[model samples]
Target: MAREKKYREAVNWKKELRLFPGYLILLIWISFTFVLLGWVLLASFSTTKEIFSNKLLASGLHFENYVKAWINSDVAGIFRNSLVYSIIACSLLIVICAPAAYVLSRFIFPGNKLIQTGFVSAMGVPVVMIVLPLFGIVANLGILNHVLSNGMLLIFLYIGINIPYTTIFLMTFFGNLSRAFEEAAAIDGCPPTKTFWLIMLPMAQPGIITVTIFNFINIWNEYFISLIFANSDQLRPIAVGLYSMINSMKYTGDWAGMFAAVVIVFLPTFILYIFLSEKIIAGVTGGGVKG
Candidate 1:
């Protein structure tokens, strides 16, 4: 028993030693992160004078900062716009990518490898290269002048830009699934489409969730695209709108309000991570990892 205990301890020591570097880096990262976010949160509640003096929240909890930011900056309009864009873009990406991924992963068809390779290649192409010609074409079409058409165009761009990454990600996860599920579904007289819709998609939930969260964050925090496309203040998303507000803040000197705006803008992604962190971990580590 003593020898057995010693062997176990020695093994654990070696394992811990091997992991020490990762643990140390994570600890440092977490510590710095908490300090920064903590300051930001407190600064949001503080007066501009207090923030500069390094005495945050000394004036008591001023919820008014949030109110001022929300109202004065017209955050509600931009927030709603971002929400609409993200929700629509994410839903469409899933609908379009999931089936494409499944078909690519499961079937042996002509051009399958080519299609996969194309998607892989597309992922490497930077958005900057294509934005110019695309923007020029849209301007020629004369639809960018209209609000609904402009919004639809933005959604289309988001969906098109994300398709390769989303498809590849879900394709890998779909590939990880055992053929047993499909086999069993076939034996039960289920069609391939039905089997995929009912069985395979649910099985790929973790990956779907993770990818959706990523797409949501990307679309929500998207700056350059929205800055270029959203010509009207009403159509502007939070990222572009926030930039405009910050620029105005330089003259208005509403530092507290700006911090509050930052917090409000950051809330959605933060809530997403908090709620779905487990799924993200599972999705990242579980990706059809074959033995």
Candidate 2:
């Protein structure tokens, strides 16, 4: 009995030792992250005077900064623009990418492998390399200087850029699915379109959700492309809008307001991640598992 107890204790010690590094790393990461976020939160409530005086760390919390940001700053308009762009771009991406991915996954055709390889290769090409050509095309189309025109152009650009990756990801996901189900549908006299829509689509939900979430986040957070394309304040997404706000600080000196704007910019994506994290995880895991 004593020897058995000693063996159990040895196993417990080994387990504890194994966990120690992970615990330490987690603790360190959490501590640093909390400190950084806490600093930003505190800064949002602090006045310029408090910041310059180095008294921001000691100042009492001021909740009114958020109200000022929402009411007086360009943040409200920026938020609206971002929401609109993200919704449109994400919806269009999913609609286009889903059907395309579904076709690519199930169909066998001449040049299919070549097309797939082309897409995968395109993924490695930097956006900057194509930006000038894209700009020239939009300019030739007479849309570069207009806000709504440029916004729509950017949406199309995002769709094109993201499609390759989304297609490949969904192809891999759909490829792993069993042929038995599709075969059964065909034997039941179901048409190809009907089989895809009613059977394969339902099964591919996880992959669809995963791709949509990724695209939504990427488009929402995108700054450089929006900046290059969008020429007006009204068209600027939150990312570029926030940068403009900070740049305007030289003249306005609205540090507190900028911080509040930052918080507002961060809120939507944060809320989305919190809510959709479970769905994203499930989608990725389901796609990874083979039948």
Candidate 3:
């Protein structure tokens, strides 16, 4: 028994020694991230000159940086644009992808495998490939800068880009769902559509919420598409707006305000990950485990 125990302890000790390098790497990364975020936060409260001069604030913090960014730079409007675009895109993605995933998962039909393969392929395709053609089509339509038209077009583009991945993500969840619920619904004379809406979907809440959170963060931070499609100052989402602000900073020299704007843009995603990280992990892993 003593020999066995010593062998097990030796094995564990070797394992820990093997993982020491990974632990050191993780610690270094965490320390670097903390320092970077702290510096940004501190700089946002310092004056523009102080930021450029590598001097910490000896004077009191300036709240005016936030005010200037919010009002003077139209960060308020840009923030609203991001919120609207993200919410609309995520809502539409769920509405369109959910039923399609359900049908694909539950029903056996012709070309089902082909459709699934197509969605998988779509997820792998880079956005750069389709941007030029999409831009040309939008330009030719003369809907370039109008808020309503641009907003609608952006929503459609977001939906089209996201649907394939969302559908495939949900398909795994749906495939893992037990058919007993459907059988029970059918036995109770519930229609197929009703069964999907009322029974299976409710049970798949975890996966749905996870996917929605991901889509929200993705659409919120999306830059290339928004930059190309909604280039107008009035319609710029936070990502593009911030990029414009960074460019303007060369002339305006409002480094404090720029850092403040970056913090504002980063806060929502940070808050989301902080609060729902466990749920995201569970949702992503649950489908594979359930199947």
Candidate 4:
């Protein structure tokens, strides 16, 4: 009886320990994330006076700062530019990357492995390394130093940069799909193109949606490329626009306005993540886990 009780007690203790570690880790992570986010939120409502005085926690919130930032500053225009560029880039990425991934995943050819290897290699190249060459190319094309040029060139650049990862992810999804469906469709007199469009593409919806969301976020948040290529205030995205606002602090001394600008810049991505987070998670996790 004593030996049996001891074994049962030990097992219960182990189970309790397992629960404690997981809970502790989760609590720590949650606390860290919340603390960081809380700082940003607090800063967004604080003025330069509050910040410099080191009494931000005791200062009153300045909600009017958002209005001034939005209407008076160039923040609205910047957001518009970001929206336009991101929309164009994401749309092109979806149209081009989807079909390419499907073909690459489905077809067997002499250079198939070589093509895939090249894509994987491209993924390893850092954005900083590519930026200089891209700038030179844009300059050679005589579109450098123009805002519209920046927006137009960035669409193509973002698409190209994101394509490798998008293709690889969709390739895994496409490859895991059963061949039986395509074979059956072919046996029913469907052409390869028709089979791909009518059958396979619909089934790949989850992966496509997931990739599109990722592309959207990437294009929306991209700063380095836009900063390098775009020169004018009208063509600046939120990232560049926010930087400009902060820089203007030297002249205007409006810390509240800058904080408001930060909040405005952060809103779109936060709202998007809040609404589509479940779908994004499901789409990514569901793709090809079986195969």
Per-candidate Cα lDDT values, in order, are 0.89, 0.80, 0.87, 0.79
Assess candidate 1 and give its lDDT. 0.89
Candidate 2: tens digits of C-alpha lDDT, residues 1-291: 999999999999999899999999999999998888776778888887786776884678777788888777768888888888778877787677777777887889988888888888887887889899888888898996777788788778777778787777788778878999989999999998889878887897777778778777878888878888887778888899888787886578878777878888888878888899887667556543211
The ten-residue window of minimal lDDT in model 3 covers: 282-291
Q: Residue by residue across 156-273, what tens digits does model 4's lDDT show?
A: 7778888887887788878889999999998999998889878988898878887778777877888887788785667777887788788986589887678778878888888888
* Model 3 vs truth, CA RMSD: 3.8
TM-score of each: 0.88, 0.86, 0.89, 0.82
Best by the lDDT measure: 1
After superposition, candidate 4 runs with Cα above 4 Å error: 1-18, 21-25, 46-61, 145-147, 278-291
**Stronger candidate by lDDT (1 vs 4):** 1
lDDT of 4 at 229: 76
Q: For model 1, how does the per-residue alpha-carbon lDDT over 89-109 read when each residue is reduced to its tens digit? A: 999999999999999999999
Model 2, runs deviating above 4 Å: 1-14, 17-22, 51-61, 278-291
Q: Residue 212 in candidate 3 has what lDDT?
A: 90
226-247: candidate 3 lDDT, tens digit per residue:
8889957888889999998888
Candidate no. 1 TM-score? 0.88
Give, for candidate 2, the lowest lDDT window spanning 10 residues. Answer: 282-291
The candidate with the higher lDDT, 1 or 2, is 1
Give the backbone clash total of model 4: 0
In TM-score terms, candidate 3 sits at 0.89
Error of 1 at 258 (Å): 0.4
> What TM-score, to 2 decimals, does candidate 2 have?
0.86
